[model samples]
Target: MSATATADLISRAQSGDHDAFRALTAPHVRELQVHCYRMLGSLQDAEDALQDSLLTAWRGLDRFEGRASLRTWLYKITTNRCLNARRSAARRRAHEWDIPGVHPPDPTRLGEVVWLEPLPDALVAGGVDALPGPEAHYERVESISLAFVTALQLLPRRQLAVLILRDVLGFPAKETADMLDSSVESVTSALKRARASLDRQRLSNPDREPPPAPRSRSEQELLATFVRAYEAADLEAVVALLTDDVFISMPPMPYEYEGLDTVAEFCARIFRAGRRFELVPTRANGQPAFGTYLRTPDGTSNGVGLFVLTLAGDRISAMTRFEKGVLPWFALPRSLPARGGLPGSRP
Candidate 1:
């Protein structure tokens, strides 16, 4: 919008014009929500923060002095809201094992970020602006990957905010400092530290090939093979598709399994219980995902959980499982009555 047009909307909004306020903020809302998700690492938390930020913005519209673009101003509000939410007393704590009838093998290590949740591809499909600032260090897709977001949660709150504002979203250091009420030097230093920490978190074997292009024939073929093997409870077939160092983590439960043998043992426990699942495909964080359903004796299928795959070349590298409660966020049904066909075909 033209500067004059935006100025008019701001004036009307300051005069309590609700529609004008909505018009002024609507274009930037989707990106702001994504920013919140990046900071808080949960879709639900991001939504809450975004709502709070908007309310705060509406009330403080009179304070917007036209020093920054309205988009940047809203980002300032959203980012701060997320930082506060991160420090809330009601933050999600790790969950204990609650699965019935199956005992998982001992985990390789306990996971630290149990509150992590997936962001549906549909939500971010056209929401992220294609053009990032020249200073962006990561691609938009890489920035939102589960690995990336998980690593983000480990950074200090201020460092997280600075890294995202200056690196992920590509804001200039000066603008990022302005948003955080810090000096440019501080923002730059925080960003530097955050980047180093993030690189350490993402470290993997140097010889591994990069993952296949998103939804390409190679990716779809791998996903299809996985669906068939997992649904059939064929451990051998599933294991064959995994990289030697594949990682598996179930959040909220805190269990993390790494290496082929450990993850195989975990999978074996589930299938060994005579439990069978039907896979319903979905996409999360620009990666292949599924809503798994357990088949009951009565022939109905109940939602069990969601699995998001991290692929490297033709092999599955990591799998992160979230509780069944997250199904609704992906527009998936909690249960399915007996049927000859799946609710959604494999990706």
Candidate 2:
């Protein structure tokens, strides 16, 4: 429907028409969920907060005032919900090496903040261009990237909200003020501080161009080689495919490996422990990803974790690994039947 049609739906919904509300909300769902994800850093939390925001919007329809567009009205609710959720965000600290049946090598250092989740780009397809304001400074896909989102998580809650609203979503400071129920001055100040903090934490991207979309011919070949080398246990081939300064990190567990030799050593430790992984092709945070299933003593491939790669030409520059609880979101099997469902895919 056109903007006029959407406005009509909003009007009807404001008058208590539930069907009109659903029609008006359909276009905004995906983007709203992503906003929550960026704010909360967890898909499950984002989904919950989005649902709550929708309900709050429905109940408070009459209070929307119509000064802002319906889209902005909905975002006001979502942003608030995410802020409340962030109040309880868990802090991850230095952890002792602890996997029951698997002995991983000692980590270089413990992670300071709770790890952020990777967003599936498919969930963000049309929602991308459809949401950004003409004035947005950051790239939408980069804003949702694992490194970017994780950096965002390090900002204080209010600063985080202001940055996402003003920079990422391209909302005006005045509109963000309304969303946060604060004055524009407060929003501006928060945004200033947020941007400065973010600048201090920003990761250097030597690859000037962004990564290609998932399943592109080049990405497919790169992913295939990575899987082959990883599965075959050929550290040399794997090393060849890695950038000279490649980084590997696992979130929520606080272990990071950087440089060729360090990453190789970390991999060697895991491989030495005899843990075999089968990677189910997937994508996340606008990059290539794999749902990894660790082979068990019973010969079944059990879900363990997922890793997404950052590419620079044909070499991988970074790898962000997330726990397997996100597999279902990618439509991957939790556990594959031994010798049958498992793809010869090893990563």
CA lDDT for candidate 2:
0.80
Q: List model 2 lDDT by residue over 180-230, tens digit each.
A: 999999999998998888778756564534555557898888889999888
Candidate 1, residues 1-347, lDDT tens digits: the string is: 88899999999999999999999998888888889999999898899999999999999999999889888899999999899998873767899887799987888999899889999998777557646778887888888899989999999999999999888888999999999999999998998899889778755568888899998999999999999999889999999999999999888889999999999998999889998888999999988999999988777899999999999999999999999999999999999888655532332
lDDT of 1 at 149: 90
- 10 residues in a row with least lDDT, candidate 2: 338-347
Q: Which residue runs does candidate 1 get wrong by more than 4 Å?
A: 203-205, 341-347
The per-prediction tally of clashing pairs is: 0, 0
Candidate 1 colliding pairs, count: 0
